[model samples]
Target: MTTDRLTSILNGIGKEISNRQLASILTTGLESFVAEDQAILRTGLAPAPYISASHAHRDGITTQIGGERFSVFRTGRSKSRLNFLSLLRAGHEDYIVNDAALDYMRQRKVAPDVIARLAGHPETSFCSQMAWYDHLVRLRQDVFDPSLVREVSEAAIWGAVRDHGLMGNTVVVSDDAGQFRIPNHALCWVHAERLLQKLMPKTPEQTRKLEAIRDEICASTAI
Candidate 1:
């Protein structure tokens, strides 16, 4: 789909929605798509650019245009009544178009004016909304401070603590390279210990010594 097409769809939806409401919907949709990856960062994984899974969710409406995903949030009693949930559950892969026409078409009916308007309009609003959505998605993917501890240097970690008011207990001092601030609730300390144990030397004597050291650290930080 092109930006023009997306804008037209959004504008069509906008006929029944306020600008603020449209913005809210778009924002909410994007946030739901991106939140999981953001939480993963708090796990101390190296931050990497990833696509939001909004397109995959049952409640999401996604269209792929120009190699990017655009999604919208649709909810309400009317949506369910109109067979939207059924379509979603059945995994129908159609883009949302103008509202009244969509409704009419649902019952195997058509309105010429709706089709005419869609064809005549340049789809400027649709294209612009899509551009904004793409920009927001890319921005979120690029800005990962929490999950990607590998990309974060020691100085950056300190800076985050100071600037972002991040708590200390959530941060993990992994090695000399830097300290990582992982999600306190999500950090798998057992996994980290396993990795640390793997770093031990092959010699049984050295392995035993390293195991003792690992035990001490585990005891100190129960999290």
Candidate 2:
């Protein structure tokens, strides 16, 4: 099927569909349609430049090209639910070794065997591996904050926009507890609704109250 036809069919739907199920509908040589659908679902997070109104989900894809590794993080879509703001290469790499990180592990008196297991490699000695693990742990500690992820991600996206010379505002919709601190950030309705759906009232009064609230919401939405 053509990309336009597939998009039209998918855009018409108001329900959720899984990637595996969507993939199954394809025969062969129609792979681009699936990618386009995913791009739409991701709100234009593809490598090519495109402005998105809003509609983003916090998701990532990993790939290696020309022997270089890349970690791509897609900003959640905006309220308009049109397209993604952009795709940013959140690079992956090993941590740098330093004295502080090593001192930390030494102070904790990490077991020798455990330390050896973490550090040992086919091409390196146990001591070398220990240093590598310590460096990695230190890097992890530096970025342990959830807010840090959001801050860096939003900055990278805006930076991309500036570099590409694009104009327009983009909103981001992500989980309530996600690490996305964009100016246009908003919690995903689907996730919020799912939480509400999970509510199980124990008492009769609670059940009635929950049902009344649900009914009101449904009525308001004309569902």
Candidate 3:
């Protein structure tokens, strides 16, 4: 419940701790602390609330140690299954790559010169650099499949997630095929709703029909 204390503990030895280890440590301590706080409140002892439970999963904490940075993102509720996707939906040229992906890229005929160039360009995002490499490969190779780049990239992600316990339970939620290419994926509802709102009927007749349909939906929901 003590955000400052937790933050201090994490920062103190965060550089030495892996994410999984940190998560385990926090979970055990937080669970016990929350349970004790709840018990104390039931006995009418006024205790200052240290942690806002609701915001715990909605906010992220990032820390820098030894010039290397790590970010911890919390998604509300403990999930056995998870949703994975990119934050942006640009073309193949804007995909991000992880450490595992670097080796995969080398195997996929990405040249050493291209890799070295990308390594020097700190301003360019991992995905963008990856896309650029894909373009280079397409131009250099005679027998080339652009889809193979994505497939290899996705496989790399799947392997990492599986190692981290997501495995088959990870659902890919993205509009872009060049993004995460997991087998089980669904369109994001928020995007779909926004797109639906943008679609307006051109004719009065169509508008009238759509309005009626909306009313019918509302009426059914009310019932």
lDDT per model, in order?
0.35, 0.39, 0.39
lDDT accuracy of residue 54 in candidate 2: 24
- Ten-residue region with minimum lDDT total, candidate 1: 47-56
Error of 2 at 111 (Å): 33
Work out the TM-score per prediction.
0.22, 0.26, 0.27
Candidate with maximal lDDT? 3
Give candidate 3's TM-score.
Answer: 0.27
Which residues of candidate 3, in runs, are more than 4 Å off?
Answer: 1-4, 7-150, 156-181, 208-223
Best candidate, TM-score-wise? Answer: 3
lDDT of 2 by residue, 143-166 (tens): 355343323233333443433332
State model 2's lDDT: 0.39
Cα miss at 53, model 1 (Å)?
20
- List, residue by residue over 88-148, the lDDT tens digit for candidate 3: 1101224434444455456556666645543344433334445645544554532266554
- Give the residue spans of candidate 2 off by over 4 A: 1-189, 220-223
Model 1: per-residue Cα lDDT over 100-174, one tens digit each: 223323333233443343334443121222442343244343324332211212122222222322233433222
Clashing pairs in 1: 3-127, 6-126, 7-125, 7-126, 7-127, 8-126, 41-147, 42-183, 47-148
